[model samples]
Target: VSGNYAYVADYANGLVITDVTDPRNPQEVGHIDTAGHANGVYVSGNHAYIADWLNGLVIVDISDPSSPEKIGHFDTDGGTRGIYVSGDYAYVADTSNGLVIIDVSNPNSPEERGHIDTIYACGVYVSGNYAYIADERNGLVIADVSNPSSPEEVGHIDMGDKAWETFVSEGYAYVADQTNGLVIVDISDSENPEEVGHIDTYSALGVYVSGNYAYVANHVEGLAIIDVSNPSSPGEESYIDTDDLAQGVYVSEGYAYIADQTNGLVIVNVSNPSSPEEVGQIDTGDKACGVYVSGNYAYVADTSNGLVIIDVSNPNSPEERGHIDTIYACGVYVSGNYAYVADLGNGLVIIDVSDPSSPEEIGHFDTDGYAQEVYVSGNYAYIADWLNGLVIVDVSDPRDPKLAGHIDTDGWAHGVYVSGDYAYVADWLNGLVIVDVSDPNNPKLAYDMLWMTFYSVFGM
Candidate 1:
């Protein structure tokens, strides 16, 4: 008996559901056809929402594990890509048209509420009464959405190049400014936002803020840690350089796990920020992209090799615990005893790691596009996709994972992270995106913006 399930939005294949209840025997469950190309999905209560490329938004009912039916949908002026739901509003990344807002008070009928047109909007997030938007070349934008129907832009930060992702904590926002690396901003005063500090991690992509540190997933630089004790003057404290190109990073216990492109899994001891050192490493012989650490084990997305597990009891000497080779693997995260692996082309793979030494493939799910990164919070797994944007999955039952909801931001999404009731994503070329996922199923774009800037003081 396996204990894993998955929901995938298989672009041309529609949305594919699989039962990984057994790692070696993943079986298909259900899928819903869409109007156009599929990009992402989200689930709320018993309904699943999808970002259907040109088709706009598609809603589906998934109360019954065996059957999924289309409920309602709406099309946007721009292409639909990433999405987030909060209260009764759905936020969509409408590509060049910027952020689109919709009303979903009635799951079967959605209505357009408002929209904020800006550069290349990619991801959106809502916190308190403000919304954060990732505006690619334009940088980070803060908007006052107390009036959801008429969102008003309040503050803006121009990050050079493209701002890929953004995460907010306390009073600061952490932004991934593509080639510029990680940028820290003080959003305490949304009207007059200021850049406090930044770490030039080369080509950084994703960012997550934990405690007093900001963890950046640098493409070829691995994981870079910066101290954020002073939101206005954050400084690089230490870094763990993996042998391969790195994409995503997650911190748990006292260690930092990295998804190393060619090196596979890399674990580091961050107990001492100034003296960060690689404690363990494993080569999966594949392009490892994202990673998450839990307890004494680390889970890695071994691109073509699927999911690779490694024991980190002895950080200095890690051993391969188990693996379930699948299609193109991208992102990975662990919750409790199960590990969720994002399979770019295949979808999502769930594995039981109760016995790290002998992991078991339990469930699987397909998505609408190329799965990029995944973040598990509460009972849902938020996925970032290249074409689909953001998809939500229900993991209440590890053995029977199901599509919960979805929203589309018209852009190429690369990574995702959940904080409080909002989910932040890294949108390649576009910028950092913020989405409201408090409702789990229906996500609405709350904010979007570019995450970097360049300035020259004439007097200085």
Candidate 2:
């Protein structure tokens, strides 16, 4: 919200600009439907920057509230969640790319100046020369943004629970800690910020500090006002119940590792699926696209961070051991000593994970289309190439993978799984496409299930 016009990110509806000059009754002035899911928005000068969830940063010209126009955009290639515009730059809390600093000096051509990867950057607030990131699970991460080209993490504090949003005022940082409520931190010393006070609230996601009161937005409990006159003993002033605006569940050995998009990697104890409990989790510092558990290690295909290897030997405390950067790793398949990754732009990347601590990309096969999913069977690897359809690669020799066969499907191929002699491909709009891989050299389309909508095709 800026001045008399309120810029709202209305999800699928895009950005909605309303005139709130009359606090009693606001009127919808103008709106622009964005290409992606509009999650967070920030208004600066005559422009309003929107953090469009998959499509990246969208810049809109709000010079005229009656007819807001989109001038330019910058694709962060990740799920952009929160945004904060200051000076000539716009800071974005990108789920997969972390805190992205964009030079919005030219609203018509916003350029990415720099970025720093965090666990799950849900929200961000820039104060002075530091950028405070509300990193879920990883807690609050403070980075020195004086130099946007290469921001550095100078201080960090684990909020115990998920840190969703933060508002800094004076010398204190008030954080909305999910499940744990409002936590106040003393930031007089940026190098070593300490938690000075806290008040529990149910699923707190947003917060705003003004004068002596802090307004908090909670998930289950709605909006709660707290008196922060004394930072040490803050008390809840009043509350009003309101309907608040609000992924992959991978289960292995009584433990479920979820590649939660904006929430990062969440591990739950699903020993009893009926009544599961969250044990521990680690933010992959990017979008946790896919996870493959091989023995004690969990290989996560973090979209922007590539393949992130986590030591899940202890489900209560999963830790990221190593990571190998890739263009955009969305899916991963581990077989024996190797981890095969289906990198979107870079195609297939074969990494040697014999050493979990230091995985190295030994070979790669650039496919004709965008690779989204992969399945390894015996000496062959089946990849779901978006437009180019199903691509078959011979992994008989992991070090030097060769393309064996490829068959274009009716629609976009999103996922693939091989079983017996057939490779099941999940074609986006065209439904299921079964390809006969009995002959790896000359693959044939066995059948096409032209009905159900699918994203991933897997065989049991």
Candidate 3:
């Protein structure tokens, strides 16, 4: 509004002008009708270029701000949605015909100079004579709209394949891309996340990073360990085969703990990673789906028998010390004096494990659907409820655990890992979903800023 006047492109009213010299209490003093809907406008000197959808560019002279005069017009190949004026020409973003350059040097007769065909040209801005196009489906595309007639592609940003399960460690993030396998992304610069490495595996369900290695749970293939010391190129050292389905994994001390559905807790001596052999095993009465090791006890979520606690202090001969019965227990997370069990049918079951010999139920939070996986952080217990999605329970009052919040995910929320203020969820068919849980009572899901706190990756 350098000319003390502002020209607005209105869909209903072709063009509307308002005097801003008075700053406040200024009213619309000029109006003009175009053949088509006025979508966008750009003012330069005394000329106001309007991108009239369907009708192309409609040039108006605002020399006299009170009453605008339509001096020139140009019909484009397709509907124009956005426009930018520079020098003697006006660049219009023609919906499907790409960038259409209209010469407005002669106010009386504006003609189309040239055009570059682009798909779904929704938005465009000219800077340094180059046009930045907001291409739908495709990431930001910078084209040399400088030469509108022969606009050449100057640069482009590539958005890598989508990831479902993500594990962030140190400066890198291990992502599980079902079809593409494991993708290593460099998140040192959160502003610009780039894929540095990737490994092809068959259906990576869960991912965990420990020391210089990355542990990936490969459904049928078992545990696939990769040397991630070099973030750019992760080399697969070896793979350990298990009896049944390997759904989740956790690396602690020098051993790799695997949750083998039918085999219960499968402990592999990862000290010698290249050729890992099963050193110890313990059955949980039923299908053991999830496991967590804290101190001398190994908490197992046995789908049929519920929470099974085993003494892993003796790595060679691990024996069951205690057990807590629950309905269809699928996941277990061991915390101080308590064991959080994700009961698929019942909901979140809290058990008191002050004594390793006997465990008793302390509290419970009845959820909506199948609670498949559980993770404990602070006074809150996050449960991945299969159909109902994420269910957050406040466990500060163990005897009376209350529902803190709940978020319905796009897909079946089978697994979750809480880190910082966001929950990195492994949504079954919906890929990786980052939910903002800074406010436990009111959780949000959208990309913004990230703040660190504790380092915890509890896999499904």
RMSD in Å for model 2 = 22.6
lDDT scores in order: 0.72, 0.76, 0.75
Per-residue alpha-carbon lDDT of model 1 for 268-325, expressed as tens digits?
7888878888877778778776666677777777777777887778878888888877
lDDT of 2: 0.76
lDDT of 1 at 193: 52
Model 3 misses residue 332 by how many Å? Answer: 1.3
- Model 3 misplaced regions, further than 4 Å: 1-165, 176-179, 186-195, 448-460
RMSD vs true structure, all candidates: 10.6, 22.6, 17.2
Best by lDDT: 2
Give the candidate order by descending lDDT: 2, 3, 1
Q: Which segments of candidate 2 are over 4 A away from where they belong?
A: 1-246
Winner by TM-score between candidate 3 and candidate 2: 3
Candidate that beats the other on lDDT, 1 or 2, i.e. the better one: 2
- The best candidate in terms of TM-score: 1
Worst 10-residue lDDT window, candidate 2: 242-251
Candidate 3 lDDT over residue span 1-460, tens digit each? 4455667889868988987565435688889988799999888888888889998888888888777888888988888898887777788888888777777789689877777767767557665657765554453456786676677777654323323456778766687555467777675554445668988887666677888888887767888888889988888989988888776677888887787888888888888778888888887788876778888778888887888898989778889999877877877888899998888757889999999899999898878677877888899998888657688899998889999999876445676777777676655433345677888888776432121111113542
